[model samples]
Target chain A: MNKLMMPIRGDFVAPRFDLATEILIVQYNNGTLLGEPKTIIMDRASDEGLCQMIVEEHITSLVCNGIEELHYNFLLWKKVNVLDGIIGNWQTALEKILDGTLQQGAVLYPDEREASSYESK
Target chain B: MFTPDIKSLLEGIPCPAMILDHIFRIIDMNRLMEAMCGHVTDEVRGIHSELVLRSNVGNSRDRLFKSVMETGEPVSTEGDILNCYRRKIPVHYHISPLSNSENVRSGLLVVAEVLHVEEIKKEQSNKSFSSAGIIGYSPKMQQVFNKIPLISQTDASALITGETGTGKDKIAEIIHNHSPRARFPFIKINCGALPADLLESELFGHTKGAFTGATRNKAGMFKLADRGTLFLTEIGDMPLQLQVKLLSVLDDKRFYPIGGEQIISVDVRIIAATHRSLREQVKKKMFREDLFYRLNVLYIHLPPLRERDVDIRYLLDHFLNKFMTGLGRNIAGFTSEAMETLLGYKYPGNVRELSNIIEYAVNMCKKKKVGLEHLPGYIFEPVADSPVAAGDDEINHINHQTSQPQERPPSLVVLPEKTPESWSDIERQMIIDTLKKHNSSRKLAASDLEWTRMKLWRKMKKYGLLP
Candidate 1:
């Protein structure tokens, strides 16, 4: 029952989503947010039916590679936990979640140390 | 009986029978026997059956015949015999000892049936196996069918770009089926089908304990499509991070499964397809530029169905045949009006959508021919019926453009606003009135509206046409 969620931004997600019809799924746990990182297809960039489906499915944590503002706000309004800015391999993001190292909310800046170390290099 | 008649009777017998003496010597033969032996000769008669079958008998024949004769059981042979004079022919020969009035055994009677070689070869050549599940006959499809062999000859990575339902997958299949590696498996994995992590494992097989769910070792699509083709449908949807990994695989031909140390290598041809403009996705920073450039090597842009209006009738007939047998129906075809209606609409879903529509229509159609009245109401409903509002906006825009008194716009300018009236108004007031004066339908409409029937229909629909 360790439900997880991950979002993928591009069509390159291992499991590609149909762009014409957006049908994406999110994962969650009991009261706690475990990133549900998954890819999905979309009819359009809209989330009218998607948000309701997520709430009905009782998804707690949504971990996606990216979510547009409209869908992001809709999920937030439903009180579903949202995690963003985690990138790289989808499983790696899930591992970070399991290890309790995944920072809550958006980590917009690519970590400070990693950025500074890159500058030095 | 006459000697010639007896000879003819012997030749007419289908069985290749021979007469033998007490010493098992050949006495007489028929024309069939001669043909079976490739030609009859005088040396062939009065010879022991052993000598005649010497070059043809099996290594175990003598034992079989001796045991049968000693036991007084009929010696039956079932095996192939290589006739020295003729070629090898499978023969079923039965030998029985002829008894005299005293019940003493005399000569053996041999009856053989030679199976023809040509008949078997003909049957084998005429055998028809079921076709693989690819289907299409439209001229556009015919062009694709023609391109399949050409695509197989090249080794470059191919990019299949087309609207959804354009049969990109079928195109990939055609390419693979015609390729040199057709015998190998053609693995397909939608880049957007799986989670990025699971997809990596799926593509490059994972070892046991590689991760929590990695119970046993698994082979990826690359392994399955080794030396064959890997069709990546919606490659445009691949995750950004995985895009980098995929790029690496394309360049180095190697990748490691999730949590696995060893890097596995595979030789698989990549054929990617997408409806979305990859250039737009790359600019949005959702797709990698390097990967797009890498995969965009050989681009094939399949034209949408709306672009090929001539193919509509061809596709309609093709689909009718496909679904008629499939649905267990004998519907004749589409009515002329239905054909005109179908040819008029701009199919947004392209071929796939058209197929679905036809399937729906076939299910709904009860009569022999599918007519316009039987068509889905949505098809006939103007675009104004939908929330898209594109039609209204375009009309208003045209009116605005036409109202500019500086220049007299073309006749089609006022077309949008004037066409929505009921068809009865048009037929009664415009068509019939004009026809009464001109005494001709075509000449009247042409002179009055300055347009043809096709153009009239366009005008009628623009005016909320009834008929």
Candidate 2:
């Protein structure tokens, strides 16, 4: 089972990791959901606290937008795969990530024409 | 939910900052920088900083990015930028490497601190005019100072010869800043660092499809520094073939860009500097004699710091005060033994070495005075016949100059010297003192420090400051 956490702003991923306040934790296996996603709202964004939560919760992978090099290195050092600079809806990103089609720096905006254009590329 | 695009993010920033790609093309800039340009950030995206910035850019040949990549260290430099209104803003910018976990060259984050024109004038109001932060009191230094304004009045191709770390680069900048072409770009490039082909591209730029990586038409340093100064450092080490190309540019104020049809004419003042003796290099057939003669129209040689009497003590005190202010420490004058070690040491590295030593001492010193223990290990290690052994007269002179008998500056009120503990014991004491003064109110303590409640909470948690 692959356990992933996405720091979401709303329908889309937060534009930045240090500024994110809400996160969703979900478990899946082979492109199918293993459990209902759990949402945790933070009082304020803290890279330190978030790193601790990722470690304590045993998150196998992380999906977020922009991340500083230090935090990214720390997560990688802890063996957690990080997908950063993703500009897309959380649901669409989840589907793509599950099917192993999501790129690390993907920009999958909600606009169908734009998203389809990226797909064509 | 407001998802911020680049435009929105840039608009929100109050200070001047820009996102630049690896090639030094600005990808996006904040509203503050945009306002200075009198154009929107989107309009100027992908433009070179030399074109966008209206100020004299001293090192215009993609220096910050290249240096950061070479050393993985951030670079900071001072220059004058002209905005759209033609108002000159003297800016000190730190170019930090912005990269993801994978690649180190994602982009560059340039954060600029603009200095007030009045402040610049006030800084120069001292009887001895100091330019580009290079100050001197000795006769030789004063002579160089006198020559600066005279050189600035004319468009002469000058050569500055000096030992490494003797502030030759600073002198070049001072000359350009005081020159008639001060309004235009003052670009510099080190011929010794990059390979000849890369240096050629940087100096003469390249047209699109000129080489494998040339994606767009790029303007060279000569073009960027048109009607301004171009500082060529370490000219002796410049490749022989490249020297001929450079000599051609010197003979005629025109250069052909790599893979370009047209010749670009430029009117640039060349101020070349080198630590090596060109005369010996010419005898050895290493440097071009004609190019050397061309660059040597006017000569200024910087004396090594060891030879400059009393300058050692003066520079030590100056750098001590500077580093102390930045670190918010009250490190007093050096102890007699420490003074002896510093004075007796033959500074092969010159002024730059002394500055580094003082900075190191300041950081290591947690006492009322910098002691011998705070100095670097090189002082203790026996070198080839180190200068005169510790003398009492020199100690007295340094102490007299460093520690003044007067109403001392209030901001640096000396506390009992204590070693910096993890998280710092002084900070814990301050937190406790502020909490007590505010009657145990965390909010008041947080506000007093200008820190958010969360930040204070974390600190309190770390130190167990609250019950």
The interface root-mean-square deviations, each candidate in sequence, come to: 40.7, 16.0
lDDT of candidate 1 over B71-175, digit per residue (tens): 767777766443322123467666665554576554444446343433345236422111333344545545555565567778678887765666677778766
Task: Name the top DockQ candidate.
Answer: 2
TM-score of candidate 1 relative to the true fold: 0.44
Q: Which stretches of candidate 1 lie above 4 Å from their native place?
A: A1-121, B1-147, B383-467
- DockQ of candidate 2 is 0.08
Best by lDDT: 2
lDDT of 2 by residue, B1-467 (tens): 55447557656655577877666666778877765555566555554444455334434435655787667788777775545433356677767776644674645455454544543673476635543567678777777777877787788799887666778889898788767677567777888878899889989989989999787677788987887899999887899999999999999989899999999999999999877768777878999989988988887877666557667777788888888998899977999999989988766566777776787788899999999989877656644432322223422222232122122334332111222321245678888888899998866887998875556756765564432
Q: Candidates' lDDT values, in order? A: 0.57, 0.71
Lowest-sum lDDT 10-residue window in model 2 chain B: B396-405
lDDT of candidate 1 vs native?
A: 0.57
TM-score of chain A of each: 0.52, 0.90
Backbone clashes in model 2, listed as residue pairs? B54-B82, B55-B80, B55-B81, B55-B82
| DockQ (model 1, Cα) | 0.01
